[model samples]
Target: MTSTSTSPSAKFLTAQRSELLSRRESYLADMARSTATALELTEDGANQDMADEDGFGEGDTLNVERDRLLVVASEAKERVAEIDAALARVDAGTYGACEACGKPIPEARLEVVPEATLCVNCKTGASLRRK
Candidate 1:
């Protein structure tokens, strides 16, 4: 895997990668807090027997919200992983090359989708296939 990072795309990818990593860390921390709260809710209900029905409903809602947040956190983690892989490609001298066609992914495309692994043509093809 040889890189062809000759233009501004490499710099943009680097910046995007760093930003994604930071965002990922933040998301993970937030998710951890939510998880801790969820666990505490279970503990409180089990041993203490929270008698407030409204409060129990609220807790249930929070659990649902926590589940949704966990999904979002997982997605952020995946995005971070992709960005890390892209950075690794940069180190391997293969950054910005389309995985599908082995062509250079345009800087504009990279700007729009920093974690893109395929060029527009390949991506379009993939979308069409899904349809």
Candidate 2:
């Protein structure tokens, strides 16, 4: 097939890339806020280690919340990193190409996941890597 991105595909990718970048920025800001809150609470001795409403200390509850928040924040950070990498690909003129097999990822897939690094087949293989 086609070696280059079609005009329509290129337009879609551009829009998708822009949307992903916006999402990445929002996530990064959220993560930074979460990290700062984590630090603040930690410094204030609010990191709790207990569960339950009244049986547990405030510190324990805070810790649990912060821990959960950290998990989410980390995932968001990873997404942002992925988006950044996709942006780099755009700059390098390979924005819509699959990283795994060097094929053009379908526009439909890219529209759904702007930060995708693999085409459908490659992505499926990767998802099964743990098996």
Candidates in order, TM-scores: namely: 0.66, 0.78
Could you give candidate 2's per-residue lDDT for residues 92-122 as a string of tens digits? 7778888879888888888888888899999
Candidate 1: lDDT over CA atoms? Answer: 0.70
How many pairs in model 1 have backbone atoms within 3 A of each other, for residues 3 or more apart or on separate chains, i.e. clashes?
3
lDDT of 1 by residue, 29-73 (tens): 766775676576566655443666557666676667666766765
Best by TM-score: 2
State the local distance difference test value for candidate 2.
Answer: 0.77
lDDT of 1 at 90: 64
Task: Candidate 2: list runs displaced more than 4 Å.
Answer: 1-9, 46-56
Strongest candidate by lDDT? 2
Q: Which clashing pairs does model 1 show?
A: 2-93, 3-93, 3-94
Separately for all candidates shown, the number of backbone clashes (residues 3 or more apart, or on different chains) is: 3, 5
